[model samples]
Target: MSMDFKIENVLSMNGGQTDSSYARNSCYQEISLRILQPYLEESIGQMKMVPCGRFCIADLGCAAGPNTLHVAQIICRAVQKKYKALGIGMPDLQVFFSDLPCNDFNLLFQSLPLSVPPDGRLQACHYFAAGVAGSFHNRLFPRSSLHFIHSSFSLHWLSRVPPEVENQMSSSWNGDRVYISKEGRVEVAEAYLRQFQEDLKSFLRARAEEVVEGGWMFLFFSGRAGACPRQQGGSGAVGDILELAFKDMVCEGVIERATRDSFNLPFFSPSALEVRELVEEDGSFLVKKMEFLSMDTEMKIQSDVDFGRMVAKQFRAILEVLIASYFGEHVVESLFQRFAERASQNASVLYNSLRQGGGILAIIERACTP
Candidate 1:
């Protein structure tokens, strides 16, 4: 089903550090960040600073949480380390935390550590910080103004669901599923792939204008191991489970069957080859390093119920707003409750699936001028 892709109005993580907030349930995201840290440091070491003794870094899709500023701190320290090794004065850092205006920038900023000395005496690095609210698919910064860009687990979100998927008469119509799955039609999967391609091209074009020549971008997103959507596995286990929950709601008459049929998720997981080809096709960035890495959960679950609840919370933190916006706020808790029950019952299988799951990390550099 199709809905308005009004990201600024509908998309955001569950805010604050409350029990269900993204900040508390983002352990998996934190794990991904750690996996990418080494790559970030290496990229910083190779960066050619923009003139005038300043460095600008933007973390796109920086949802509200400890992970938001956590990225900034890692980046600042890496740049600092590079400068120290070169025996040069470190440039003033300007960090931008960007996301849709609906993001909880208030909580993100409030959680930032107290100011440290500008001289790098009290910490590894220190600099200015600000928030920019807008879709990264559009131009968000001045032309050639940024030195580095980082977007984690954000690129998978399409600008909107493909229009064809919403038209009931269209061959690409995605009926009864929130995302692509093993049972999905070939035409529907192709529609999603095409949308991802267009959205990715827009993202590259915008960043090409904003980032300085020779700047770097380190990106991470959920992806399939194979080139096509249906290969490897399918959309994802979590997405499948979520769909079943919606089905259960429909069976119980809580939501009409048409309602379930009309709500499609605006997300796509591309393969690494797909990402590389898209970047090369755009003719801006040179792919530096591309690899797949798995995110291991830190929590030790004592039982199936605990594991199920943990998984449910993670999805809720990231997806509650999007789901609630389409299905109504009252249905949100009940949906996740159904989700938890199913997940707990299949805990062992889910755990094994998660252990085998991984994502793509693409480190690309803005090609230098001739």
Candidate 2:
């Protein structure tokens, strides 16, 4: 299916090198590892009794860069350690890193470190990077081939901005272009839910084909509180601060209200129940674990200054891509001016506000089916 939106560009923007933010923000990777470790252990335990054969692990929605591979390396090392303890021979393993066609796979491939030896002989770790453009739900990997499937900080992105929001049929947007209208709010929430449902189905189907019958799948994502989107906070405190910044831009006429409204970022954070329903509906996977934490745990905002800077950097990156993609290259200066003006005041207060907004994480396993 053709994507109505430029998902690859947005993903690139989201994945830009924000070393401080990623390092400081433990929620995405740290918490994800916590949930993933057990499954890895269990999968490795099962692999120990089996005959030496090829083992496959896939990182879906792996952005075109080192960050994706960085995680893969960690998992590989963990699995290797497990086998070492069990005194079982290490299985030949392959790591498949996947993302969209527009992603910089060449850059990712070029940056991979040279192969090292796990034994006296060369390590049998094979790296393959492929682009699975459209929706990841459709086709990700071959059926019954994946031993483990891991995705973190990626699933929340909707396949497309809800059609209702695009048509302006919903009242979510205020005259100021901020999403203040109740109808607009509901519309955005519904759109996200619908997109998530479709995406989840595709994800399950694809994984069902790729993963071995008893293999494991772990997914960690940002989720909202409560059943409805309105019940939750913004995209952490930083996102709220950005919204405030956008408001100022609108008031000063630095950016058109419609321009802001036309910009769509579709992210959904489902509650535990919502996630359970989504997984169970597929009847192919079982919910092994699920956890929801506030923004503090998810994003790891230790201080107001750090929080402010993190939010600022993310907005700056997002704005850079949005300007290049939607408006033309020339409008970046004006956009930066608007961002600067909005972020200059009461940084501490804005940071505190963002800390109040948190996110969620989840883990699942493929149930052995007859």
Model 2's alpha-carbon lDDT is 0.59
TM-score of 2: 0.78
What range of 10 consecutive residues in model 2 has the weakest lDDT sum? Answer: 173-182
lDDT of 1 by residue, 103-187 (tens): 9999988987858766654455666889999999899999999988999989888888888987899998888887787677888
The best candidate by lDDT is: 1
Clashes of each: 1, 14
Give lDDT tens digits, candidate 2, residues 99-183: 6565556656776774656653436333433445545756766677777777876787666555556555555332332331223
Whole-model Cα lDDT of every candidate shown, in order: 0.83, 0.59
